[model samples]
Target: MTTAIGNPYLEGNFAPVSDEVSVNDLPVTGTLPPELNGRYLRIGPSPKGSGETGMSHHWFVGQGMVHGVRLRDGHAEWYRNRFVRGDVPEDSPNTNILAHGGRLLALVEGGGAPVSITPDLNRMSTWDADGALRAGFTAHPKTDPATGEMHSLSYLIRPGTEELRYVVMDATGKATHAAELPVSGVPMVHDMAMTATRVVVLDLPVTLSMDAMGRLAAGAPESGDALPMRWNEEHPSRVGVLPRGGTADQIRWFDAPRCYVFHVLNAYDTPDGSIIMDVVRYDTVFRDVFRGPADGPPALARWTIAPDRGTVSEQIMSDYSVEWPRINQAWAGRSHRYGWFGGTGPDSLRLSDDVSRDRGGSFEPGPLVKFDTATGEASAHHFGTGRVTQEPTFVARPGAEAEDDGWILSVVYDGTADRSELVVLDAADLKAAPLARVHLPRRVPFGFHGNWIADNEIGA
Candidate 1:
């Protein structure tokens, strides 16, 4: 079926310009790229400047705006203020550009890396209330899940210096706390994940010694080593879990192997007790290098965290790589179960792969696989090629529903003029052809994250 909807803001090429000027002292804001506008949410990449090289300029400020879109028809009726903002230096193309949260809790991040914070977007603008930018804050803020309050952490990087000075802010975007996190002579923080009570940071320690061959030959090493490792001190892929209201001394440390870069973590209460789905990028290098069978595939691992016992058990899921997996909102208060396409091995497609290559590089969308937590059975759907699918978002059928029954919504990038289509799949039997395919006029730009807002709660 086909339907046409008009975007008033998008109608006359009337693009929203960045209120802030560029780092280059230019008055013009870069193009307002078109992206998927969602109900109570919107995610897109805001470039720093104009032209091809502008897109390559990683230092450009990237913006992610989440607002309320009409659920009945995909039209943005109202918008929450821009929550996630960061300067993407050319080298760090993998930073997070997406933020996902609800009316009460919103999580914002800079690229895919770890500056994850919860922010409140449904408030009266400070400018509307106070009459000045001076009354406002400069840093992008995230919300604290435990307290349901907003907070922000700002960092300063000086020329020829590696340390990052940070300032934390309250809900009103006012600086409430401040500190400096030494990049240890490194450029920036790699990735981070958080829970209600703790902030987990994945800092990559800069290395001066060892050439490419020397580092690869040495493989992975512990913290304080010269090799390129995941969470080590020299390459500090270390995890610092600090209590929400506590001091740095209360931070707990954990070690990740050379190839494992931590992704997202979700707290779960299993029959065995509380555990966490500690997702990490496995067997992938941040830098572009030789691609061959030697490269390992990404995978996810489950870790049992018993705070009282102060013990952790690392149990790897046998067939799943730490690569990207489609995660749905947990049902029945259960932990999240991810679905995606591709084999769990060294050859798995990763985001870092070259997109223009004939082989279609690593980030190419693969098959559909569903993971069952209760059975631990990874089910593959319609294996092999045909429909190229990337990240898949899920929507529960309106009403109290069965666990296995819901609609799985995803954008299928068909690689041609009719570039993409929104396909709905049977959540229980993903192998079934799409229940519906909603065609689009233009290809929706590749996005990082999305969520489903039901009809009733929207347009209220």
Candidate 2:
């Protein structure tokens, strides 16, 4: 029997044209070459989801050029267009685009090596010293700020068992080492994070008994019940930190819960040789599989490492309701402070005693919270009940910039009009009104990640 499926690509009334504007109905110029002097570069899949049989969704790299509007006296027009198209498949949720020195690195989802897009957004032709394709490949590549070297880790699933072997690569595209890791109940190696000096792998070692149709049969439901899943009295989560130059025996392991269902939203290195990782630890009894809330409002824990002494310390910075899970956090500045924003959800006061009755599910309007890392003092700025602000991208203003402050650019959802606006806030005082709100013609769909391209930069 054939089951009827709803069209996943249904169109909605999300796009809104800006008012106080004469060009009321400018058509969307799809997949066109970008103009020069554009400031922003965005990389994502083509509008159509990846379901077409033979054709692949075009991976787009777009540039936004800001121009003074002659029609609207004081306003400006930001023309965005795609400059490059690649057939790389983006099956995973996260893709990365980072500007390193003069070259742009594009990391697609599938198992290809990382691709290098030149300042012009065109794919580069040169291979690295190891003779690997420098462009149009896949791998998670992150550049070290101090040394400017690129590091990546890739893994392949073992043929007959639930295990994976990883290959670590350096800036010159050379495979430095290989090792095997047990995969219990966790997802594939597609979900991993890395720093300049270390690679962190999250794995679960429990085998799932399956039926004739290959569906999971009855087994222990909780991750903690998995035989090989690791947890300890202090950390209570399984984490493996492999140093870049260390031998297999020198690799360090820590216990930490899997916070999110199948992904690690963010992870970064700290100055004091610690790692801060965000995870969604499963709260089994309270979590609902179909319509239930997310697994956690995961906390950002500090994992301190003492290579010489062979020790690690895990400390939770802050934890909140599961409804308002904090996803991303960044160091604010010299004060050693950090600020983060929670996911969509209603105010805590509005949550009913019974969670099933709560209307909060996906992205509900939330607030931005700032914390003093040294003192653990925290404060929040809730935009409001109907207005949603999210995916804040913070940048330090150039020059002799304020050592303790930066600028935050976020997408604001104005519920009343069902439209979205770009809101810029002073990181120091988030409670203040946005410095500017550039009204958009439609809802910029919720996005995973973004980086700022300053105006004075060469490409812009």
Candidate 3:
């Protein structure tokens, strides 16, 4: 059998790291705040060594590795990287790293169960939520700030099943709600939105193509080089709202226009009973993509669902190419004014929405986008040329008064030097200089979501 010469995902900065290192008392530029006491942990896919390199390596598929910075008592304590166990066994946990039920969980939406790890970045065990979360779980699961309940719409692709499960787990590591929802075809449902009374699920145009999968399994050359999923132009786009803690049969489905959302910023319900949500929408996905993301760029869009009127309306907020919308987690499942995102500037790498078989082009991340939903404004913080950043996590100051009273934490990779630094910026003034920079020994490639686990909240 012959193989393609190059795959974009396996080359350049997207390449996997060769080793995991533990460094203590990393150098710091500015002062670390005393109130910021906890671990800033981020997870993403990173295959080990050159053997994992291939033309078929999608950015979304790899072994998951957790890179963390320990913050405690006004000092940057340590930085460590570890491979998550039990999922791919010898591969990547590459998706989202989360803190739930007193354990750190590594999640991937595609078909692997959550791999629980220790607070200090040690491998623990594969969890099924006490036999509650079966099949597999998604990378993004929303937790209710009011009730401490975790909600997930997990999907499993068997031979002849078109059903997915909606499972909810309470604070103490116990599964409380489990129900199955019907779907016509298997879609790559990456993320979901949670409101006070409902969890929003997207059934978009991108669905699994068994024909493509069969070709890959049958040793089709290019099948090993591209994603098996394809865009279904005829598939209707829609959103389903399931009542919090309600069974799958109770889900209310509303028709939506043709689009796709990979991550939701924040969502809430109006007093008039309409659900309002902010998401990063793409015109198409998995249709004519290169590595992992949608072929077209994404925008910050709003979707308003009226249960009484039986209509779902979408409003595009900003056309700036962006994804990975994050707000203060405390404001999740409720209304919030501000959110942060990993956005692209004018010269950033972009994908064409048209179909192309050959590997096309690539670009680095542009700026950290600070979006104000209330004022309809977006400000970008550029990190110089060849320097890219990942999803910015908002860390609220203890005893914070205003919603924007916090610091934004992100791992900024300097492509020139081939090194990474954890940059902290004032949440209120995103354009300002970094408040502090915790330099690391190596680069942490651009990856998925993370959390700032307050020391009081975890046993690290």
Regions of model 2 farther than 4 Å from truth: 1-38, 41-85, 88-94, 110-141, 155-186, 189-197, 204-237, 245-250, 261-293, 303-314, 321-336, 347-365, 400-404, 455-458
Q: Write the per-residue lDDT of candidate 2 for residues 99-166, one digit (tens) a residue.
A: 54454555543233444555544334322325433222333444444454544434332224544445
* Model 1 agreement with the true structure over 1-460: per-residue lDDT tens digits: 1111221111111122233211111121222112222342334333323321121112112334332222233322332334343223222221222232322222232212222223333332212012212211222333453343433332223223443323343444444554444445333343344354444444444233244325434653222122222222356444445544444456565554445453443444455543464554454443432221113455556656555455555656536443334444443123555444333322334335543122212233355566665567766444334445544565655452565567666555454453445555677787776665545333444334444554332222
TM-score each candidate.
Answer: 0.57, 0.62, 0.93
Number of the predicted model whose lDDT against the real structure is largest: 3
- Over 213-254, each residue of candidate 3 has an lDDT whose tens digit, in order, gives 776677662522335666788777899988988887789889
When sorted by lDDT, best at the front, the candidate numbers are 3, 2, 1
Given candidate 2, what's the lDDT at residue 45? 27
Positional deviation of 280 in candidate 3, in angstroms? Answer: 0.4
Q: For candidate 3, give the lDDT.
A: 0.78
lDDT of each: 0.39, 0.40, 0.78
**Residue 129 in model 1: shift from native, Å?**
13
Give the TM-score ranking, best first: 3, 2, 1
> Any runs in candidate 3 off by more than 4 Å, and if so which?
1-5, 48-52, 87-92, 221-227, 345-360
| TM-score of structure candidate 1 | 0.57
